[model samples]
Target: AMDDREVLLTRQEVTVAEHGDWAEVELYEAYQNQTWERQEVVYYFSLPESAVITGLWLGDSAERSERFAYRVSPRGAAQAVYRHEVRRRVDPALLEQIGPRQYRLRIFPVEPQRRDWDQDTNRMVVEDGPSLHMWLTYRVLIKIEEGGDVWPLPQLAEKRNVYWDDTSDRLVNGEPMAADEETWLPPAVPATSFVEPGIHRVDFPGGESVIARPASDEDLPAWPEDLHLAVVLDRSRSMAGRQAEVRAALAQLRRIADSDTVVDVYLTASEYHGEEPTLVELSWLDLGSITYAGGQNAAGLLAQFEALHAGQEYAAIFVFTDGSGYELGDGGFDVSVPGAPVWMVHLGDDLPLGYDDATLEAIQASGGGVAGDVREALTRLAVALEGEAYDVVDGYVWDVLPTEAADARDALDGDFAPFAARWLILAEMQRHRGEINELETLDYLHDVAVEYGVVTPYSSMIVLVNERQEKLLDELEARGDRFEREYERVGETEGQNALTVTGVPEPEEWLLLALAAVALALLYLYPRLSARGTLFTKVSHH
Candidate 1:
């Protein structure tokens, strides 16, 4: 035992009295004054600015949400930041399995913020360091789940520390479960307080991340009770009854019901007769109830969806087929829906041949999102009708790829289609900088390679980019104008902060190099040619 008794910092429990759990959890820390030396601190935690805790549990574990239910903030707080709002309630069995636990917390700051300390003395006093650093703080999230989706179980909540962790504990006023050294403990009293509902946001210490949580009763952002949909299909007959594409699209729609989103499906048949048409909502058409009898009627298909889902909102209808207009005068894929947007998915290889560009534009102008391939199209429908995007890297995956990080990457691999669009702005910046000149280009390429995690860097692309920049520079130099240091930033703020230029090197030097090589080839030609021609003539004479 130590000569002096360490002072108890704070103690509290999260569950209710119904559990008969007695956790007189106490914490004793060395000390955390900014004035203290390095040894004074011991642990550190980091967290993103925001997160939507779909699930959580106490302490570390191997389960997804249950494992390591802690989230650390990247920003360091030298002093303890109190959050009085956190509340908890749990069953007695949970606390018993966990056992009586006490905390000895500490904050470890990185370099440029190390505290100096005397080797032998356990002094709580401060010392000077080479440099001072910022402080950060991490908090705990004690999870409470009823083992299922049913939330806010009134009976489970026995009591709570209406004001917990922020300040020292007051008397255990409600009821007592045990007698610890200093105070009587309550059989974790239950409380009625729950997390304030509806888009409650939490600010991180540094402010880099933001997450949003939604309640079940409220309407989602960008989505309404009445969802709208339009379908554009390819009708080139090659796709006629090509059950593969339809099955995939319908399967995607089926997943929507799980999230409680409404959807409307439309069938675009370019070859169907008398429908010389334009885009329009399927609901307004003279369509009848769908039987889903493994046939292709708009009404039958929709009814199938309705049968599968509860009373979900039937938002938009999409049609994807492949057939040309039946007659010469038939309008084919040309459809019009001024009010709701039509999602025209062209099936198979050929989108409707000679599909009117004006009609396609009109359909898009009606405010519909498009889908190209099965993967992209399905994801698009989910976002459009579901009104939410999957939470990808909503938390800090960090540089070190943990199992969770790998999981996030795997999900992102299918979700984030990188090839969809190239980084045009960064490409332009790399190009304009003449960053790819000779060995200098090697360094520039190396940087980009590292950024993109490319192991084997290509030298050829560097040379091409450098050559192009040099040629442009030469043209500008010849005009008695050179300003490589100043490419207009596409936007004001972007130009002001990120994009900077320095100088423009004339490409005339390269031009001269090219010309000199040609001249050298010409220079060695005359005598060698004369000799070769004479020798040829003599051989002929012989």
Candidate 2:
């Protein structure tokens, strides 16, 4: 503390702020007694080429005149690269392609010429005291291109040099900066943003932006009429807890359906018990008296849908279950009811083991339908009946344009225009399911990718099933090890008994060895002995 000849960096701090794909980084440094020192600070960072520099600020105040002139250069480059500079504080400073990998920002602070005595040398020397303060802030937008994987650039490391007056400059500490002293900034963590396969609107800080190109209006179809909805609810013992929720959802469906709409309600459980899943009139339908019992039979329920709607044409059929049902084989559900989309509503968390969400998705997709929760299934039915362009997020219903309806129809697999006209509504439902999260969702998607050869943006490198499989393998290995140890113990016990049989065999050992030898002899001779007559036959022949 007594030595005034040493320079010290008293304070250094860094702050990072993130907004969606964009991030703002600020670096602040304060040196002790270095106000008159002329120092050059260079920041080295790496960013994806897709990223664009949005803004830059130098000094403590935005209103303050630029006291430092900064230059940006690409990695391994000798000269500074000049690009577009925005004078307005609100605007961002743009830089052109400097290089492929890394970039550097060099900042030079203005300093006054001064001199001081070298106390150690007892001679005059130029003052190089640490008394300077500098703050640098910049914003970058990490643009994610279509079908491209990109992450935000991390914080940059600082390279600094202090000059002895204006004439002579020396590197700080006379050596390279210590790794610990040069703080490396961490990358900004991006928020989870979901984008459905089809075109949809995404809300950002400034305004709403549309992601993915939308289907053209000429591609949609007209809304269908004479549409009938059949709801097949799972009344199994497992669904006992969710009965109230099912009743409420049914009530909501009744409210949404028009008076002319024909809604048939069916409940399935063990042996097709309870109400027989009959086509009860909407008004006479009783949600209260419905009881839960038996094991779930999804096959029987589908058979009923096929029987009831044999001659009649239905707009859509919904089968809601706890996803626990008789194995419909590896191919899953292949039955398709003509002129109807069989929407599979997988209710509750107890999905069948070995069978995943992709199986249900494939089943529903094969039947020209979709699979989701109770709310989503009903919402799709409602939207189809309305036959209008409705935005699920805004809840705004637009007048059905001929071209728009045609575009919607083209989006779907069938000629049913209503199903297509409300494609956006369906798109919203597909993306906003509650079951999707970071961990499980990624794993589920990975399973889907492996099984069905389909990969989405949500797919992660980590396979979710691997952990469960590993646990199972560990359990099996432990059981095998225990069996092996038991087997060794039995062998050891037999060997000890053999050792006890010394010159004079113990009665028990002699008896056991005799029995074992007889057992072995019988096993060896059984096949050949069977060719000869039985003991009773031999006695009789003799």
Candidate 3:
């Protein structure tokens, strides 16, 4: 398996075009493979919370007309198409949302090229290699703060999976190379629609407009002077050195609340003696004496809290954790805070995939929220408590034809009706989460995603070479998650079994054999479980 460093990011160019309240951003990236064997590049990064990916293109040529832009389909179908194309040695690209505010891009079979270290020039230069050029465009509503509406840009943080420090002075095609540090966008004047104090509607080219209205005081619940708050601390191994930060946030929370507010602090991985209510002043000292150790016991902590409180309802419950590894006692995905609205605040830099799912489940079950940090969690909680809301656009009304936005730059002109429809569907899905059956909700979302050509949790974007591939994708989509596949054929060598077939289009003999070897190698290295709950055995070489 190739690591993150094998495929070199040779060049990057970004263009930001602003259109009123929202902005369209296009990112062009070129990656070079220095190895002799084919490679698949997987890039994992985050975008703005409100950003929506509208387009993606992959090709060897720089000309936009020569390349194919991917169309939206069910993620499962797109994945099937990508797999089918990969075996045939055809060009295909995929973009998927792996978690909240996180995305993954996959480009396969980057043709082998070469680069060597040049001691004379004191630079490792790219001798010759094929470059994979990619174009990604997304639209985001600008952030309106105290000063002005700021267009959000991609943050190429050093912690991202694809990044290189300054120590590696490298050159691509004899040109000086460095990683992208910042993005450039055109400046804009203040948005008057936001500053005005009345309900307003801004319409796009289509018969659609975003409507905003001020939040009235009647919309908020009455604030309670005597509020009971539960603070669940994740005393797991991952929180070893973050005690001071958590303590500081707790102190700030206490300061924001009334003096008579009751506080109960509990630690995971420790036996809950019972609901012993501690004041902020008392709990502040007790928190200093606590030690951090053991795996996260989120499930156990919630269970203990339930046992102690039983019928007692609090203002809200706050769980502090990095959403990392859990101990054996933790309930894993089955964990839930049933009685109260549980706000799970991530205490780390990047939220893990498992944790993100767990937080979403918790939120859906309890009706609270998940924040990237403690500060955000606190601010949102204050707004909910005070019956206050930010004066931003409430929602958009648009004639959404999910299937119509097939063009690459469909949303570039501020016609975000499809994107708006996608969000509306998602919001409805969230509202009906616990009410409707799981299968029904999933089916509804999947149908809408495919019909509207919008990328949801059930949908993704994939590039196909021909109509056959498109038909093949439809078949795969019909099969759904129950699509059982096994590779049964190998190369010309007898007594060798490499892959199992699911009755799709067959690849050429040479490509089939090449795929067989690759399949066998991959199976031997990583044992994959089939859809029927069976694992394939390693093939023996003669």
Candidate 4:
């Protein structure tokens, strides 16, 4: 395949090892630079919604590589270190989440190809370009849908040189299962039953096991009989053909509504009906009339929605959009909704291309949660309004087995194990961000991310070249973690000033060094010239 902008995705191979309820997915990618200069290859990808990143490795050759699972640091510090190391022309790879199920992989200095001689032609020949290979592995809980158990792999936009290695021969270390061997599956747990709050374990292949526990059982507040709903619809250019889907999703609200339910519809790119909440019947709310045009202003539309209903309380607020052209306004949504929950209903089949995970997390933290589809949105809304618990799992989940698994290893030996813990922890990390007590929340998330060895917004996956680089990362984290403690004691400004990390010299420092060298040279030559006497010039002044 032809390269794109001198960056060629030479090869991509994915291996899926399914273990009943969950699967381990390993993706290998090779990139080559087609030009005569070093390059930074940036690739964007998306994975299953329930996947947890567990490992990342990068190297010039496949035989040896550096692992990113060695250390866990705050995202900002990790980014700063990555920039610093990249400037030094050292090996450092960064994998960060850009949106829900969306990730950005950055590998530096794809070295240029070496020139060679053509003996027969009596001309210079160009050899193949240098390549960088990366291996990424993550654990995903199998999604149970109407079709069957599904494990979604990373979907890359570039389809060239890609291979899916899920054949039976390669499913388990290139060994196929015997025909007489029976497959194991986890014990069936009814979706409606109330699971106890504690650590639960399940066994998997290779003596590995998974564990999970419920987080909470807090029921939704009772719905208001006189419901006043405000729907913020996105009218961006990307929503042109998706208007029908939005209308159909909104029409489902009528199913759970009482006769008193009143709705006010506001378009993100259009003028509102009026200052007063224009009560439209659920059946008569004509979403078809709202034209999809211009860019989406989610923050401005929400502000207007709240402004128009000043001194009034709403039952619930629904934001309908595919999250394209979505911008995060200044600070988090600090508005007081008077006990009303904000439901961010995603309205597309694809992963949101524009909005990052932060935007969705912030909205969910504002009292409501994110719904994957129209049916999920309607179901969650009904549950929230009616104060009835439906399908929900509350608790912390982990990829590894519980501490108690060691003592009961023999007893717990089985084929199917509850491997949903890793996904649970990943989901909790998303919600744990942007909490009221920011410091404590970050501390908790950082610990969990490190303990589980997963990449998250609070924590990032950073691959270093050697031991010295590891020391540098450790030092940087120490400085940042210290500053976090100081931040609570003194204030934001003083705390930032107190934080300092030593690494490769900055540009300003290098400039200062150059000036000092010139000054020293002048000082060294001045004495010699003065001693020679011929350099001195005498002048007569009036």
Q: What stretches of model 3 exceed 4 Å from their correct place?
A: 1-3, 76-90, 114-129, 144-149, 156-228, 256-266, 270-285, 297-315, 323-332, 335-341, 348-361, 364-367, 382-419, 435-437, 446-454, 480-542
What's model 3's lDDT at 408? 31
lDDT of 3: 0.54
Score each candidate by Cα lDDT: 0.27, 0.39, 0.54, 0.52
Q: Is candidate 2 or candidate 4 better by lDDT?
A: 4
Ten residues in sequence with the least summed lDDT for candidate 2: 80-89
- TM-score per candidate, chains pooled: 0.23, 0.33, 0.65, 0.64
Candidate 1 residue 142 Cα shift, in angstroms, is 31
Which digits, one per residue and each the tens of the lDDT, describe model 4 over residues 1-542? 24335555555555667654456777666666666556666555666544668777887766643434435566666665666666655677876654446666666667765444333443335566657778888876555545444555665532222222222121222333222111111111112222223444555333534544333434333444666777766666677777778767777666545457777666555443323324354566666566655554444446556665555666667877765443332223334322466666667654443233344344444445556556655445655455321223222323343344434633442222313333333334334434523656666656657766777655677788788778777777765352121101100011121125455466765885686688667545544544332232222110
lDDT of 2 at 205: 24
RMSD of 1: 28.4
| Candidates' RMSD to native | 28.4, 29.8, 12.0, 14.1
Candidate with top lDDT is: 3
User: What is candidate 3's TM-score against the reference?
Assistant: 0.65
Q: Candidate 1 lDDT, tens digit per residue, 306-356?
A: 343334333444556432321122222223333333444545522322123
